[model samples]
Target: MSVEHDKALAAKGRHIALVIAATMLGWLAMSLFIGPALGLAGRYALLFDFAALAGFIYAAVNIFQLWRMRQDSQR
Candidate 1:
């Protein structure tokens, strides 16, 4: 790929990372405050935690993919 294309991809990756960070923060807020305020039970709260975990895993995968792409571009 051309340098310009690689740069575009890197920019996209940064945007995705920002989005993921925001989503994770939202999930954290929901799990910590919203759920309790809504009178959610432990099980329900646990579900929110699970959702956050999934988001974290997804974010990690996305970051890894971006890193790989950067490395490939360097070669």
Candidate 2:
């Protein structure tokens, strides 16, 4: 592959990593503060917890994808 193509791939990977990290931080903040500050009751709070878990799972997947991209680029 050409230098420009490699550079573009690296740039894209960096952008994806930054966006995913920001999203994960937002979810972390929401789970830690916003969810409880709303004063949700038992079941509602449970639902919110599940939503937070989903967000974490999504972030994990994105992180794995980033790792895979880096590994492939090294090859």
By TM-score, who's the top model here? 1
Q: Which regions of candidate 1 deviate over 4 angstroms?
A: 1-3
Give the 10-residue window scoring lowest on summed lDDT in candidate 1: 10-19
Compared with the true structure, all predictions reach lDDT values of 0.81, 0.68
The ten-residue window of minimal lDDT in model 2 covers 40-49
lDDT of 2 by residue, 1-75 (tens): 568767866776676667667666765666667767886565765665577567667757766776776677678
**Model 1 RMSD in angstroms:** 2.0
Instruction: Write model 1 residue lDDT over 1-75, tens digit each, in one string.
Output: 897877888787887778788878888788888888998888987787778788778878878778787788778
In candidate 1, the residue pairs with backbone N, CA or C atoms under 3 Å apart (3 or more residues apart, or in different chains) clash, namely none
- Provide backbone clash counts, one per model: 0, 0
Model 1 per-residue lDDT at 51: 82
TM-score of 1: 0.78
Candidate 2: Cα lDDT at 48:
57
